[model samples]
Target: MSSAVSNQARPAEAGPARQPVPGPASTGTGTSGAGASGPGPGGRGPATDYSGYPLVGSKHPWRWVGTAAVALGVAAVAWSLATNPRWEWGVVAQWFTAQSVVNGLLETLKLTAISGILGFVLGFILALMRLSASPLLVSVSWTFSWIFRSTPLLVQMLLWYNLGYLYEKISLGIPFTDVRFFEVQTTTLISQFAAAVLGLTLNQAAYSAEIIRGGILSVDQGQLEAAAALGIPAWRRSTRIVLPQAMRAILPTAFNEIIGLVKGTSIVYVLAYSELFYTVQVIYNRTQQVLPLLLVATLWYVVITSVLSVFQYYIERHYSKGAVRTLPLTPLQKARKFFATHAVAPSRARSPR
Candidate 1:
């Protein structure tokens, strides 16, 4: 009787703790009362878990929208290609192999190679002069650069075409004296091709000077300071430490300018030079296959440009030492890499146990 009375007294004493848990008949929020939690008072409140809730986090709605837009654009282009009635694959194939077009391509390659080399050489010299400390050198370089840069390239080419009129003869003499040692008529001294080369090269030099200056400036000043601290000669510092790095930075832009120069060379048609464009103009004027000949010029440009692009890639890779962490692949190289990867992937997949 004593033990039973003790157990009954214990239950009454613990009633406050038991009140915290919701009874089977209760219907309420997880809290049992104003201050009590749901599971027995301190025995972990009704396990108020959020793990059962749906998971949500940051999502890129714009990325999905962009993907959809790209897909739609591709589909539209495909539809246009599929439905176009004027598409003539056969004619295009025939025109692509025409002899005139083939000859034009060869001529374009020659012209581009020659002009690019000459322009780069001349431009490099101008760039050095422009950066010289002497005010006289700077002024001379500035004046030359400004004259060429300010004047339209087309105007320059035309002026070269008619340069003979400006000077009947160039006399080698002392300044402010007619004491001529040797003289030659301008026409005898310079051919049309030579004149075109001079005009194009000078114009290209001006632009290249600016490009080179930007590259030189892009190199960190700390490099020059460090070279000086090491007691390196100024010329050695510039040639070895500075210029090599600057060239790497400027090569891509320089390559682009070279490509532009290649196209610009077509403007020499004004002088009736038998370059690729002149060839096309002559063919079209005679044959009147305007669109086809124009296509011929376009094809020639594409082939020559494509070849130069590959050359540019190799040149860029050569210069990109120490600075570039990883060199990027050319389009052809990337395609080759992809195919090589795919070829090995299947073998790797099959060899596994």
Candidate 2:
């Protein structure tokens, strides 16, 4: 220790500082070896080697801060929801699976299914008509969309329900002929259910026709022309080449319309048709539990939309093939990755220093 102090005190006595020390490569370790700090050919000192040191990760304090802020906000909202008495969550639970409510839910689902299927079918035809070269077909398709889209859905429902006033009877027969296949009073034909279906179907069709047409139009014309050059049948080109690609564009919007139709089904209450919303109205009217009943309907709608959203995500993912290099991870895969990363990070932090 006295000698080291003397060396520091008399630095001028030492000659010019030696060049940077050689690394482990220059100093042999196996045969007649010199250690990491041992001298090289010219007796050079060992240079520092960073490779032996433990790695340190970057820090992002703001990231943690933002995460904490969002977590606190979410927790506050959840707390409020749990503590609030006016939400009447118990009442929501009570009527949520109630027989009448369930029955009404079934009716809503039934209406949505029947109307959605028929609406898309009719819309497909209308889309074809709109896309066709014939002027009459185009005119008719455009007129149908315009008429339905221009008027309020409520008016349409009301008008359809009261059809008996304008048309005494609805008949299926050869036009300009006496021969009739079927005939019935308009009131008998357009019952509550029938009117509701008709209104929903026509309104849905009007929107869906545009959606399908837009999707079809989005497909490149160059591909269709090239397909024809290969002598593929027109029908085959449309179905195999065109429809598949068009579906990628169509499915998202189509599902949106279907979800909209689910909510729109509530509008049938105007006809006094007992769908979920109408049933909720009836219950609340009798019990004077308006907010709770509305909450029930809102929660049911949330559940339905949530389910539909999951379907939309997967369907969109399926069609995304070839469009993206790698498919996005599923919810389960993301959860696994998150846990794996954070779990390892904590274990590493707690490791022996």
Candidate 3:
């Protein structure tokens, strides 16, 4: 009777057992749940959906309209130029490759080559002098650059051409010395071509000196210090380390100057040196085909400048290797990529049913 009463009391004290809580993954609601269709580990959400869907691109109506407008404008200009007889396209073709024109072109190239070399060399020396520790050297360099840059190039050329009037003879000798050195007539020495070269080189050197100096200054001070610490000779440090790096800054401006120099050769026409422009002027004078001759000169200048620009682009690309992680695509590569991206494959023709 006591044991039966104890069992009844224990049954009355006991409560109902608890159920286990459902996890997010099991319930299909959290990151790992069945309903989650993403790109997460268990296909969590819409991100992981690989079902086929048609690709759609954004519309750019304005871009198409602008391109069409440009095309129409270009077409209209081309039509006008083609129909205009005043342009004398026939005459342009006639004299485009004439012997006189070819000779003039050669003269222009010769002037450009010689003047460019001399100008850059003198400019480099002036730049070094300007940057030197010696006050005398720096002052002299500064004064030379200042005077040449301040004066008009045309005036300088004219002055050089007429140098004989101011000084009948040029002599190389010690001042106040009875000892004689060779003396030459100023007029004989300062010919039209010589005057042109002197004027162009002096003027170009002034500008180029500043450009080179700016380039040199662009190099980091630490580079110079590091080279010095390494016990590298001054000349070696300058040529091998500093200048190679500085060229990255210098080449663009230098090439612009060169292009300008090519055209600046025309200024020598004032001295009666028969460069391309002078040749063109002479032809137009004889034929009275002024516009056509002028056009020929313009076209040749354009071609020469274009070639230099292309050369500049490649040179700039070469120097840019260390500055950019990846080089830019060449024109040909860019064109290929553009066509590949825009090309559409033709749809297959359906067979007759």
Candidate 4:
């Protein structure tokens, strides 16, 4: 009787016509059909659900614009080369690979290196002057810095070249009187090369002084206080704690300035110094092929600059040791890993959860 009652409560089995069937509508398609096409009881089936706007990830109008700009630049370069008459590779190669050009390049490099070292040394003293408590010392340094920085490098070079015209001789004399102890002949005291070196060094010192000053100022005030609290001498504190940190801060800028000075030595050609540019001018004047000679100078500059760039990188890495991370991989290793990961990823079915 209980089994019959249960069967009666369950209701008679429905025929196919009365039974509901799962359809595409039940899967959120929202289409109406009897079989899989019909919506289920949930009423949320896939339908002509074009009621919402289409999804696009973020749009970048500027990216398209930049791409167009780069395309135009490349086109312009190609057009210019085709139209211009300056594309003689033979002359360029000959002059570029000349022995004279090589010598000039070496000389240019040496001058830049020597002048830069001397300038940095002098600049250190000037930086100290600017930081000194003594008003006189500070004023003197400020004046020197202003004069050199205010003047153009070309003007300074010219002035040094013609220094003999201003003074017959500069004598070591007592102040306010012509009580001369020793005299330096103006002509002998300043040669073209000497003047070039002097001008470059002095101008560089002014700029480098500011670089150093900025570095020193970047040191934390609390660090200085701590050093004082520890009873460290003022000089010792500066040299030991402050200067080392300042050097690290200033190294990158100093390296850039050094590179600039290397290129800037070309300006010495105005004085007829037989530096790289002047030598190139002499050769090209004789050869009468200006473009080729210029190209030679440029190539030499590029080569020397490349070498110096490596040195600068090493120096920067040395100073940046504690500040920045060294990469885990060498460039080649990193590139290899990158390609391998992308090209040989594990198959999805083989991948572990």
Candidate 5:
């Protein structure tokens, strides 16, 4: 009886048992307070905070400083050039559009066009020969490329100009038939312009052959096999399939060569062919305005090269089909888009009532 009374007394003395309250189930609503309608603490909800995962706020102060420094340097140089009287800006303007200069410009363009066409055509044939199965053809192509490329273009030009010294006559006829169809004095056959074209074309063709070969090699061997499997004729396979693809690789370097050829036309000054550079020399010799004349030539070259570069950009874009998902915007398009995006005025925030 006493033990039972003691147990009852112990129960009466002890406090009430506390029961655990169940937390709310996550609703992915990023709230976890009373009704789960607001952020819980530290402005973050019960859901794990990943807002700071990709950490920001890293700064590189030197980049801005360097950019500003470069801009200032360029501006300074430009200003100095503009103000310097030694440049003889007046003389540059005077002869910039002279008739002789214009004629020289035309001649330069002519040489570039003819040389580029002939060189590329011959180069294409040489490339084909290099890729041919016949040992004799390969050897001949290799030897031609080797000889032309190894010799200085200036030397070649000189040699062609003086061809009369080596061979008085050039003949075209059936070999060993004593039936000459045509014969001409070497000097008469090769005028200064003709010699320049021959030299430029031969030199350009040698380098262009290597470039073409490289482009052809860049195409996958599997592509050739596939074309062959389809029973495509060799010519058709090369021209239709392989060459089209190879052009993507070829165009950039080929354009570079063309531009070089444009500049290379200047070397014909040695033969006294009156291209742009030669024209400049003639004017400078008369006027003794060396700096201005040189500047004129430099500016013309820059303009021509710039135009070619622009053309190259468009051609490259044309050939980049299927290679890139989206074409890049033109400068005009980019400028228009930039102004459209940035020219708008921002809305002003209203004060709270």
Candidate 6:
């Protein structure tokens, strides 16, 4: 009882219990010293002997099946194209770069360039008008878009071509006076080219206005307000802050519209203008090689659209800088990655021991 009482009464030893004297192993100091962890040399975990096991890749059976099916379909289409005699591929090759066709192509390009530039410029102004505080500007913008967009493009082209029936003369003169600065007969003034340009430009403007307005609206109002609060001038704020952000939203749709316009130039054929489609029609009508001539036009259109698509991709990539951490890979980059991964893997697997 006294021993127990003395043991209990004694003050506890200070700090921790006495530790074992550290040897080479515990101190990890000597060349041959091994730690208590029993790990590989240099404290790494044991080296796994993966060479003994064969790797089994994850199964994607459905994916393989889908790929096989698509390959077969593509092969069938290619075979059909090869064997079909009605395609008259020789005629297509012959006339593809003929002088007449080239001239028509130039005309088509001219129309597209002029109409696209004028349409977008007018549309930008109309978009501003639509978004303005004044009721008159908004109403005028709305009415113009409504009338143009609601009517068929074909009708507009016809109406513009036939404007002479409604007005004997077109003039720039005083509102209610005989004095005139310029005057021309309506029939002469609204020739085929002039009428086609007028119709396409107006129609394009109507759609472009909406596209621009939507893009502008997509920009956050808070940013604009913040810019204003920070005393950034309205013009600077619009050009610098709003436009840059809004373009990201606008570009994809805008490119689609432009592409559509390229095809839409076909409608100008009704006016008997010498655009690509009209030229093709004339050739086919004369030679009776309808399919081949049409094929030539189709190929040219495909080439144009493909080029535009490339431009669209690069432009979008440029604008995506702030939106994405990494820019999306280009087709060339993707191809390189694909080959590197698959080709390297197969070669590595077949490598000698």
For model 2, give the 10-residue run with minimal summed lDDT. Answer: 11-20
* Local distance difference test, each candidate: 0.73, 0.86, 0.85, 0.78, 0.84, 0.84
What's the residue-level lDDT of 239 in candidate 4? 91
Residue-wise lDDT of candidate 1 within 215-317, one digit each (tens)? 8988999999999999999999989999899988788899888888778878888777777788788876886666666766776677767977988888878
RMSD of 1: 13.6
Output the worst ten-in-a-row residue range by lDDT, candidate 5: 13-22
- Give each model's clash number: 0, 0, 5, 11, 0, 0
Clashing pairs in 5: none
What are the per-residue Cα lDDT tens digits for candidate 5 across 1-353? 23333444444222211111223322342223223422343435455333422222324568778989999999999998999999989889999899999899999999999999999999999999999999999999999999999999999999999999999999999998888999999999999999999999999999999999999999999999999999999889899888878888999999999999999999999999999999999989998999999999989999999999999998888877877899999888899986676567333222111
RMSD of each: 13.6, 10.6, 17.3, 13.3, 15.8, 16.0
Worst 10-residue stretch by lDDT in candidate 3? 12-21
TM-score of each: 0.71, 0.78, 0.80, 0.71, 0.82, 0.80
Could you give candidate 6's per-residue lDDT for residues 63-131 as a string of tens digits?
Answer: 878989999999999999988998888999999999999898888888888888888889988999999
Look at candidate 3 and tell me the lDDT of residue 316.
Answer: 91
Expressed as tens digits, the lDDT of each residue in 75-180 for candidate 2 is 9999998999988899989999999999999999999999999999899899999999999999999999999999999999999999999999999999999999
Q: Is candidate 3 or candidate 5 better by lDDT?
A: 3
Candidate achieving higher TM-score, 2 or 3: 3
Question: RMSD of candidate 6 to the true fold?
Answer: 16.0
Candidate 5 Cα misplacement greater than 4 A, ranges: 1-57, 339-353
Residue clash pairs of candidate 3: 36-44, 37-44, 37-45, 38-44, 38-45
**Candidate 4 least-lDDT 10 residues:** 9-18
Candidate 5 lDDT: 0.84
Off by over 4 Å in 6: 1-57, 333-353
Q: Give the winner by TM-score.
A: 5
For model 3, what is the error of residue 2's alpha carbon versus the real structure, in angstroms, after optimal superposition?
A: 94
